[model samples]
Target chain A: MPVHPGEIPKPNTAWIWKTFWIITAITALEFAIAFVMPSSTLRNSIFIILTIFKAFFIVAEFMHLKHETKGLIWTILIPMGLLIWLLVALITEGNAIHEAIF
Target chain B: MSTISPTTQAISDSALDKPRTGTWDGGNEPFNASYGKLMMWFFLLSDAFTFAAFLTTYGLIRHRYQPYTGTPEAFEFSTAYWPIPEKVFNAFPGLHGFDLPLAFVALMTMILIFSSVTMVLAVEAGQRFDKKDVQKWLLWTILFGVIFVSCQAWEWSHFITGTDEGTLMNDGTRFFGANLAVNQYGPVLFADLFFFITGFHGTHVFSGICLLIYCFIATTNGTFEKRGHYEMVEKIGLYWHFVDLVWVFVFTFFYLV
Candidate 1:
């Protein structure tokens, strides 16, 4: 097939609008949860989980990572996944330090 | 070799004669991604770790100073050595004495997120080779980015000027707005970390806006159209979204949690 110069490819507008709404909805939910829910471990966990959900959508859909090849996807996701372990270890160490101090 | 069939010998011969174009030949995309996109991903990955370290340190120090009570509500309302985030961040611009906790930050968050949406739309326009649409969306994204930065500046100024003069401490001394040495808000470290973390993220936002402006000019000048692709817009879209992604985590760690 011959290609024409300066021709733009067709875009998926529906998908874009859908993703926009999804992100907006999650943000609204986050704000609502923050206002009404009492600050607790559970509330904190909810916030973290919601944040991850929003991050996933923004990365996958908006950043177009969802359409990338498996190898490329793993290249980015695997290293970021390890950061969770870092979070756990550091926070635990922080707790130990807190206990040791006044 | 003596045991090999004629077809097997032909197959082995062809394999041996095949061109040895190693992975570095630049012909093959091992991960099915272009060099620019792949490099951007790697940069973002490392950058993500930097932010993770900052937030984790924030958690470590904050937990040490946080006052705990049996009741969950008490934690939010606690007057412990650690400052309550809700209390410290509870002021809106032009709404004096309103006591609207997290309202301004929430507005800022929404603005950033909305900008992300516009960025994606711009990328979509780029995909269709719609130069005008791309310019329009990019302009909107840049406008929102500038608004977010201005709001941040206002918030910082309000913070530095010391609300209500100063909060009295136990030693009969009054501390004013945040500085490296002292702050009226909880521990001095709290103010330091807040400035460092948010300031770093805000800088990214500023840079992202600058990049968008360059892309905007390039688009108007027919750079992408001449090249027959809009990969530049797509690449920058990845960065714009990454900025938004980091803000989501920052909002969680600094504002909501």
Candidate 2:
């Protein structure tokens, strides 16, 4: 694609280290919140949100998905979207079962 | 066979020599990526679904119980409430008395992330056709990976060894450590997910290490040089990064949250 076959375009290496530091910082922040925050729905939700934020950086930056073609990006992400449905449905079912029993 | 005209014969011959434009997905490489690269993405995508299913089931089973809110001192393994993960995972290796919980797991997360960084650096070196650099970074990546797996082994062993105090079951017997049938933890299901999810991820990390060793050997053998590219490194890097990505989630769901 870079005027010859098998040619990989050289991207900035700085980006890699940058992403690493960002991830490390985010992880440190997660640790800080975990130690201080009381166990509550809001705290758990924040953890999940931060986890997603970390995931975005990994998928989009480290995996190079953001720089890829739109079609390619969609191909990878669209199928993953269905996982939300499975999670939601199963969680509801699990909660129901718990109520039924106790 | 001799019935074809000369002009028609020329057209057919050229067609055989060169594929017509726009024939394969509007002419350009599909998604502007190679067949192997595209396939890797799809494979990772499927693999993501598999991990998602496992973790989603964990979430489902976890939500079945009311959350544990007991103080650290009051905590004990029982089916009446879920055990706070930190309390269960508190003991650090070597030091017996330290009630450190998420500290070691956090270290594992950092190690895995650092290895991923090394792997991406290898990919960058590969793109630059710097085989020596590629090999160097790859060795680092593999080293970190092995270290990560070793740390996990320790973590799993510590988990299996459990606490010296152990837990007294409702029955007269005492429960120590965990296995398929018995878990000293709150619910048997928690230990099941712990072993299954973390074990599966560990297996992936091991596989990625093996793949890196292969790449290292190939780089030494001038394999990528002969092929005029180093896309293989990129492919394996994708896999290594995915392993790290999965760990990110596992750390949150299993340990932190």
Q: Per-residue lDDT tens digits of candidate 1, residues B1-257?
A: 12457887788679775546677764577788888999999999999999999999998888777555444334332225676677778899888887788889989998999999899999888877788899999999999999999999998887777777577776888767777777777777888998899899999999999999999999999888777778899999999999999999999999888
List the candidate 2 regions with Cα displacement exceeding 4 Å. Answer: A1-12, B1-22, B25-27
lDDT of 2 by residue, B1-257 (tens): 12347888788788564545675644568888988989999899989998999999998898898777777678778867778988987766687889887888888899999998988888888877777789899999999999999999998998887777778888968888988778788788888899999999999999999999999999999878777778999999999999999999999988988
* lDDT score for residue B57 of model 2: 93
lDDT of 2 by residue, A1-102 (tens): 112435645556899999999999999999989888877889989999999999999989888899999999998888887888898899999899789877
- Give the docking tier of candidate 2: medium
Q: How accurate is chain B of model 1, given as a TM-score from 0 to 1?
A: 0.86
Error of 1 at B120 (Å): 0.8
Score candidate 1 by lDDT.
0.84
Q: Largest TM-score belongs to which candidate?
A: 2
TM-score: model 2 vs. ground truth: 0.91
Model 1 residue B188 CA deviation in Å = 0.9
**Per-model TM values vs. the true structure:** 0.88, 0.91
| lDDT string, candidate 1, A6-95, tens digits | 665666678877877887788889889988887789999999998999999999999989999998888888998998998898889878
